[model samples]
Target chain A: MSQELSDLDRRLINRLQDDLPLTQRPFASIAEELSLTEQEVVDKVRQLRDDGLLTRFGPFFDAEALGGAFCLCAMSVPEERFEDVLTKVNAHAEVAHNYQRDHALNMWFVMATETRGDIIRTAREIEHDTGLEVLMFPKKREYFVGFRVNA
Target chain B: MTLDPKDRAIIEATQAGLPLVLQPYTVVAETLGIAESELLERLENLKKNGVIRRIGAAPNHYRLGMTANGMTVWDVDDSLVDDLGDKIGALPFVTHCYRRPRALPMWPYNLFAMVHGASRDEVHAKRDRVAELLGDACRASDILFSTRILKKTGMRLRGQKG
Candidate 1:
């Protein structure tokens, strides 16, 4: 929470992840309901994005529907080679999230593929190219974890 | 209009708790006083327009026997991120991977991944595999197991009151 946002801002953000108003005057309709002008609503949304409070404002597609498989994976790299390994991991479009943590296994990321075979193939390729062991932990069961950041 | 009144109503209703029946659509249609065909058509349009991503179930993993779910973070090289991210994202078990701003003060990891398994040991074994794949660039990594599960649901359009 860097700076306090107006009530209208919060409401707009809450709706961003959901179905956006699918109308010619989507912003205006939402504004009317929230008792704010369309311009004001748009302005607030832009500000929220700029503030980094909103990671993304769009639909979260069902990966399974597309016949894609996803899971979490991580690896512990020597402190010296951290930068080189990071570049190698982020090059792939399937790698959605990558972060650093405070532990022996300091780096983690998520991977999704159209098929299980692809997931394995990609992991093996990375290991071959980087010459580091990539710990592949496929998700056996998925527990939804919703992350919300206040603006 | 991207979503009509009826379409909005349908989305609001089924955002969570999809009817658990063979003809869930029919039941939802009857409740909304719309024909099943009409409901299905609207949903199709929404999907085409990228409004509603998809209609599916979000199961409770813990109940399904996956007791351990951990967030694995990595510190990947900036130059290799795009290449490695694409390969990592292709993994079936590697769900939901994306680039995020790193946390400050001692934590400098840039790659993040998640794994779900029956037990903690299973997750650790998978971690070893990922480590083998990452090779020299991987400086360090760690897993933060979920201690508790909070509210889990589809997107909520109407903000909840405090």
Candidate 2:
């Protein structure tokens, strides 16, 4: 269920998505732009995060630049062991984003590790752990990344 | 180039999220026993090196009224992948796009582009546009609308729990 959002909240979401001033007084600068007090802007930001409206509010790091390996892996688990497989796959610390999709290659997850070999090894380990065939789809190239989302 | 110990420290400190304050650097640096100016300088350098993509508010798509999202996969001819992937990635609504290796029989889609919208119908329309763009070079395709997100941690190093 979606919650009813206020006009201020909508404006905040659109504004905060970009134009985050990098300054000594970032919040104060935002207040100046939005005509609200620094404290009010700060409080609303806190509330948005608390309400799970804003997932993150800080430095955005790209894994590839940090010498880390990131790839998407999937598996087609039997329906009888779906829950059991989900629990096992989700338990790993390296699983970045796991999703239950509507296809035969259903169980899809993003795997992040320190090395390229880890991407291959993790795929094998997951297959062994889940007793299912793992299809590793490591990114060969990135055409575009971190594109601006529509506000 | 290797990561400086100081840079590593700074990233670890702000990995979760930075403080919501006037002088966030001052607060973060004070905790790390460093000067605000010094932290700012390092952050600037990191941004230049592409380590830090951005220092801003990363809004949740669902909260922003983008309730429908799908990962559109395509099996395009290898010769035209570079041409096709770039074209699809350039779409305004495509958030994330990449070319990945395909496993035969089971998985034939090598190109992946993320499609998101306010409704499922909207998502399908976007997918059709992509398909039309791919044309005959695209041999096969499939879209996997995420039914559930079991786990999601932006970026985590080995053995590091978020």
Candidate 3:
């Protein structure tokens, strides 16, 4: 849990997320609107990231639109092999985010590929490389999982 | 980070709808008239550059029986946000968690978490667990359960005219 953001930081980030200006000097545009310098805005964003306050700053994609397939996969990697499995899993560009959970299905990750073949191929490859069973649960019906960072 | 014509084409085509076939990449390659390996390599490069976040299935959780989902916000102590966020994010029910700038004059809660379950009661149970974990450090919280899904899709980086 965290306290509220400062007025300046809140406005800057809200503008950034809601409608990132598409201009040559995007930061400058944002800064002008916020009554801050472009450098200040950039610096604040960098600081927020360094403080681990910002998960990430950028565009989110629609996986289905890309002709690729994706699924939420999990596995229980032996403690001794956690690092090895993590390294191999992270090596694949398809893995968006992976975490070590506190459960029987400890390791969980998201995998996406340009095509269905690539999706299956990459999953199998990871299984072969890590020697762990990857349980993939693809989205059957999507419900809204809003990413609005509430600012 | 700049994409060439071929790379843009591949992104546009695949983002449109990767052919649902045994050899989807091959279809993309054929349309692009390049080797499959080339297409693969380009995708790898795009991902490496962070131009594309991921290539995966965006599951319709509601269709799979986990219909209840809510955006739970917590007023966590600023000093403990990082550790608490990591712990909260590690929960299986919490598919997404992040620290966003707090909403002004309307919503003051900063910490946010999402939980999904088979039913509203299930989601509420999970929320109770989170509330217990959070304890007194939280000042206020709210759950905005979704009533409708607007739209969902993958990346469309190329088509938008800058």
lDDT top scorer: 2
Ranking under lDDT, best-scoring first?
Answer: 2, 3, 1
Candidate 1 — which residues are off by over 4 angstroms? A1-151, B1-4, B150-155, B159-162
Compare candidates 1 and 2 on DockQ and give the better one: 2
| CA RMSD of each candidate after superposition | 16.7, 2.8, 17.0
* Full candidate order by DockQ, most accurate first: 2, 1, 3
- Per-residue CA lDDT of model 3 for B35-96, tens digit only, reads 88888778767666755555422333543356678767777787776667777777767877
Report the number of the highest-DockQ candidate: 2
Docking class of 3: incorrect
lDDT of 2 by residue, A103-137 (tens): 98788898888888888888887888988987888
Cα lDDT tens digits, model 1, B1-162, are: 344567668766666544433345667779999987787778767688656563322323443355676666677776775566655655545554555445433456677667667788987876677676777778777777754321122324432224
For model 2, the local distance difference test gives 0.82
**lDDT tens digits, residues B35-56, model 2?**
8888888988888888887777
DockQ scores of all models, one per candidate: 0.03, 0.62, 0.03
Cα displacement (Å) at residue A63, model 1: 13
CA lDDT of every candidate:
0.59, 0.82, 0.64
Stronger candidate by lDDT (2 vs 3): 2
Model 1 achieves a DockQ score of 0.03
- Name the better of 2 and 3 by DockQ: 2
